[model samples]
Target: MRTADSAAEFQTAAQWQSWLSQGSTFPVFQPVLSLETQTVFGYECFGRLDLSENVASLGTFFRASDQTLNTLQQEVGFTLAQQVAQFFSPVKDARLIVNELPSHLTALTPLELPSTLEALQQAKFPLNRVVLDVLLEPGFQNPLRLKTVMERCHSLGCQVALGNLGSENSQLDLIPYLKPDFIKISLTLFHRSFRDRQFRRTLEQLGRLAENSGSALLIEGIETAEELQQALQLGARYVQGYYFSAPGRLPAPLPDFQKKLREALENFRMIRTKRIQRQVTWENEMLLRLVDISFVLFEADGLLRLNETDLEGLSGFIHRLYFSDLNGFQISGDYLLSETGCQIDYRDVGRNLSLRPYFFDHVYKLHGRPGGWSLSDVYCDENSRCLMRTFSRYVTPQAILYLDVLWANFADL
Candidate 1:
């Protein structure tokens, strides 16, 4: 588990350049998967080479390379690009995403690309199939030069990508202005409140921009199946990283593994759906009970009073309705003191109440609306906990006659 810093300790710029000149780098290809097809669409280029006591260490070598490393980086990138072009031949419609250091543009001109294109063409490679991913490390400062390079590559029919994009870095959004053919979102953003609805909305806005400008979205560093599912659900057209396939010189023979992953994802979906369905069934069942209880309470003479002990006894029933043993519930209305209750705080009923956020919301808003018996779908509380419940009230068009409760306190019933 050595990091970029740990890798840096073993190599220096001069040694890195020497390795590049000697063609000592080993190339690995990581598969990119299509969101819709769930199949391998292409491969992203990665480099690994043996360094001082470190076997096949990309992190260390790249970390150690400094300004002196620029010469070697350009040379290595061009040579690897050439190798990738050759490798992709005979795999019709398959693409290769070669990593490019921004500094390499100094050595590469519009004219030299023709020879690279010619080599690929000779190998029966499609010119449009090559995508050059411009890696945006902290040292990549020359945006104007990067723009020029991107324009030159695009004019030649090759696509350019904004690799490792970030919101904190002002330079990252420059891709939209330059109009790269694709934008590869950095993995860091995945952990940055991506599960939040606001973040998803922001992502949707970005996706819309990319769509309008004809730029494709490629999400990277999808290490887990859950992450891949979220990215695909969020409209990422392309995805890549260890979750799909690790980098290698050749495509990994993983048809069975791919099928297993697919089935696992499908199972995840089925489990979620069934869990929701179960909650709905419980809510419906509780609603029927609430309706029955409301009828009994409505026919009572006065306040129809019930106490904390009554609430406690109904805690089991509440547990069934809310599916949470931690909750307690109470219902209070004028001329209706029947508490099918637990020790739940009345002040907290609809606000600080432990029920799902949407459930609380529905109850608080239900006051003005006509209410017989109704249930809410599962939703995250403000604390991001899921809850389900049903509430029913016996009332006339002019006044509420009785209130009945079914919540987490009775969810398990």
Candidate 2:
């Protein structure tokens, strides 16, 4: 996987200009899909050359051209804007997202969006059906230019999207202010999020941010079925990749491509629903067990009168049992039963649990009301290094009961 950063100038500016002038190269489109509607949202434009039964990527060529052909958009992009006008219908056709050319991404020059829109207008392409994709490079320093470009797009009835997101060097801070209609993330980040916890957190936050900020999330480079599933899980409404349709000189592949998306969407929903059901059932089962244990604690009079010997009954199901007062200070010894049968530890009695989410969140949510069990987010248990969640409830007005359970014990079911 060679990156554009390391891309060497394979052709001079003069050579690319000569090749493009022959009018042999034209626009190719890869579709962007809306998973929710299960329909094609739009097509993303790329430059394509008809090479006698073989085709190569011209858009990628200019982007990875680095030092050379940086001005390709000035010539070739404008040419295809005219050609593209003829290919798509104004109403029936889905929108097209054009990548702002590599040269136009500079801080030194004015944004090319105004020029691109002017080209689209000159070509008679429908302004309402165009989406401009702006890539924010690692350290894109020109916010004013980008904001101005995006404003122009909206005013012209064209949408704007921030592209090439989720890469390590992608400029994320800009997404908030620009508030483009869409944010496009590469498939590379989808794969990384599965293995890396911190990356997964970032991905989750990105999803939330998109939802809150009214930007649709689009995942690109989905080459496989598995990648498509992950993108759906990431809550990406718009997706682009070879899985649904490949890039080609287009009249658009609507009939066949729509059929493919229909099947993919059907399969995704069935699988996703079953996964949700399984988790829901596990949660219900856990909640039932917690309730049963709560009954037992009440029988022991909120654990105040319960001795070490009294803790023996809850052996297998309950890992540890203790209580904290209204002020979040531990008030009761841990009561547990196991092969060791009946153990109580007061060493942590005065420990403060105030700052922990299991404490504060429970306090805040149930503050006025004070009844109801709450579960904490999963974390690794120091001793076992296994995933753990704290289950908490108010057993008495003064005492909040805490139970530690082996999360996998209930989860494996």
Top candidate (lDDT): 2
Point out where model 2 deviates above 4 Å: 1-23, 50-54, 64-70, 89-91, 101-114, 193-202, 256-269, 292-360, 364-369, 377-387, 404-413
What residue pairs are clashing in model 2? none
lDDT per residue, candidate 1, 1-413, as tens digits?
22133334435676555544443555667877765576677777666654544435464454333667665555555555567665555455467777665655534565655333455655656667878787676655677767777787777678888777654563645666778888877666665635565566456667777777788888888877777766755567887767656676765544654674466468657766876788678667766655544222222232223333333334435432211111223233222122443333233322223443443444455756655554454333343243434343324442232223334443433
Per-residue lDDT for 1-413 in model 2, tens only? 11121113445676655554443767777888887777778888776765544554565555653455545645666777777776665437588788773236443244345455667898777788889888656656677766776676688799889887877677777788888899987557777986875566578779889888889998888887777777777788888887777776674555665666667778788887887788678768778766655344433433353445455566777788788888988877776557767677767768788866577877766666766777776666655566667878787877888887777675433
Worst 10 residues of 2 by lDDT: 1-10
State residue 331's C-alpha deviation in candidate 1, in Å: 37
TM-score of 2: 0.77
> Against the hidden true structure, what lDDT does model 2 obtain?
0.70
Badly placed stretches (over 4 Å) of model 1 are 1-7, 10-12, 17-23, 51-54, 59-65, 106-125, 139-141, 167-172, 194-205, 257-413
* lDDT of model 1, residue 295: 25
